[model samples]
Target: MNTPHTAAPVARLAAATAAIAHQKRWFARMREEVAAGAPLALVNADAPQEILRAMGIPYVVNQWWASVVSAKRMGPAALDSVAARGYPDDSLQYDAIGLGSMDLPAADVPWGGLPRPDFVIAECGADATRKVFDLWAEHPGTEFFPFERSSATTAPDNWWEIVPREWERAYAEDRLDLMTSENWQLVDFLTERTGRSFDIDRLAEVMALVNEQAEWNRRTRDLLAATRPTPVSVNDSIPAVMIPQWHRGSVWGRDAARALFQEVEQAVRDSRAVCPGERVRLMWIGRGLWFDLGLYQRFQEKYGAVFVWSMYLAIAADGYARYGDDPMRALAARFTGFTDQLYTPPLSSQWYVKEARSHGVDAVVHLVADDVPGSAFTTEALEIAGIPVLEINADNADSRGGAAAALEAAIGDFLERRVLG
Candidate 1:
């Protein structure tokens, strides 16, 4: 349980980094901290794990765990084993699980002998995440606190259909900069020994590449949504993996899109799932299913419908791929700061819909969030394309709120009218 590497307090910098060549070494260090009693806090999937590492805390990832919990319809059960600490229930399941994990004096959920987390850091960026954070905080004795700004921008204005440019001022709320500054401070603490300026340009570059990545993402999405191009399963490509990669942006993000594009082209060539001179290829635009993934199951399988795209995945593929070599500028251009007010121009529904049409989607399932500014635009643009469109309001993760009912009605309505008219 001794991480002789990071534990040397301050004098062992050189020896510590030298030993970091292997991930096992670092995992051992984190394990040592957990065994010593530090609780773990898990937030969003796109959360930068390095933040916890830089702070020397032990935590588990929530995206996969939440996916598991939601899929099983036993959200609380997942955290019982990790935090065992109870949390506020009227919030995101993520927070509930995280709070429960932190409240637990010991691992109570079910992962067997795995180390239990001592704390929880949940978020409210979207619905699922919001609850994840709130649940963890209401409980006493658990080290849960409000995650200041999990997203780059927070001003709700930027969240909608037309994110006004002046609204860009809202980017200042991002607290990650605090963590980044602190990490660099540590880097500076060792700079005399290591002799470097804690170059953050790489991270900056990481941000910039999102534009090109976004473009490519859009291309792939469009191709997949085409009438007879690529036939991808929502369960296969959209749900399981691409979503996680969407946020990280760049090398891997672009690569995934490229591979997906190639797969689409190959599928089209094979003439398998795609109907030649075909009928319906639609876009499923909305928050993805977390509680039950079967949201689009009936339409997809029964209708011989090919769903080639989802929003975030498409955004990353299209919004990112713009940067050629220099990416920092691109990152600053795209996500210098963003928060989920989703009502502003950044809500960019027109952009998304246009991109959808360009990609050949026959219609869209625009899951409208009353809060998002341009969310309604998602449906309008699709209908304009002469593609049958449906506006549904199922919370991606919170079925209890309205999604379950909305889902049944929407699917029925979609099949009945065949178009929103």
Candidate 2:
């Protein structure tokens, strides 16, 4: 928690970061809803949130809950729960962390404990996500639903351009068709169980709101990319952009996006510098540094370095937009290969290189998760594009006991010997 320089707390943070507390209250309300006999879902990050949103079912994202567990430093105890259940604690730490915590005592659980899920939905990714959710479904009242995650067949050089309008060309037709059909099955399954009919009109409305939120995020990202000395920190941007993202396809999420855009624009107008001594503009790749977010600002005084970018905000701008008459088809197009664009071969490489250039990042710090594919290609692409990369191999959530100290030392070494020197 030690920072080199304690800059004056900026007003930008106050306006942009309502999601921190809002999410807690949101989770608590969801628990209440589930306890009162309402059907609740536990879904993967890539699972279709819009479907649940439109159905009026309360749900909690598995990864969001994993983050809460990791942030509270209860990751070890949670993993112990996994180990007690005869599962290997090391494998799929990010996806399984929440499952392990599910059996913990209420006093030990994060966010007042996650209510048991009625529906557990996830895509088959990394050879582990579906299995993790399958285990969750083994609980008495939960039902498991899974879809396939296809590899990237098309590598559009700049995904931000075509994905919004021409996504059919950006991704293969088979992928979208398969996902759309699966969504139909999912809709049928939910209808048979919950007795609530799926409404296409409502889904279309959700898609529209999601697009609006993405547009505002696009504005905020572009503003950050164009600004000198960096108007806002990635630490701040992560919550501002991602909290709304987790609750996407709602009026509140879209409004949050607009609020974030306006807040960043005002910071630019005021010529705010997160680190006034800013010299190195850094780009953080992979999942968030949830263990120690203050790590983003650690080298500010000594190295004049500031982390200006993280995928949480940038992907929001370019990743979530789809426009079409059929809401199911559109939603399928939105998530069919969403993770592929960031973690697959040519698509992942091309997009990261594009982002590094657009952000004018002086250096890159790539956190390579054990279960995620394609970190080597991403690093190679950035280096080939002439941007220096420091690969930190660790789980952003589990921390592996000493991962925080290791990351801190490695980044300091990277900045001194490679970047600043």
Model 2 stretches astray by more than 4 angstroms: 1-12
Against the true structure, what is each candidate's TM-score?
0.61, 0.96
Worst 10 residues of 1 by lDDT: 1-10
lDDT of 2 by residue, 259-301 (tens): 9888877766666678866789999998987778878889888
Looking at model 1, residue 221 earns an lDDT score of 60
lDDT of 1 at 132: 54
**What does candidate 1's lDDT look like per residue over 1-421, in tens digits?**
0011111111212211222222234346656766775555554543443334333345566554554445555544544443344433444444344334434333443332224444455333566555555554455544443333444444433232232223234345345354344334434443443233334555555544443445555565655555343444555555323442523434654455455556555554444452222345667776567676655545544564555566655554433332323332223323333323222343454456566666676667776643344665545655665777777654454445565666767665775577423
lDDT of every predicted structure (CA atoms): 0.46, 0.86
Q: Which ranges of candidate 1 are over 4 A from the true structure?
A: 1-41, 45-64, 76-219, 225-229, 239-258, 274-278, 300-302, 320-343, 369-374, 380-388, 399-406, 418-421
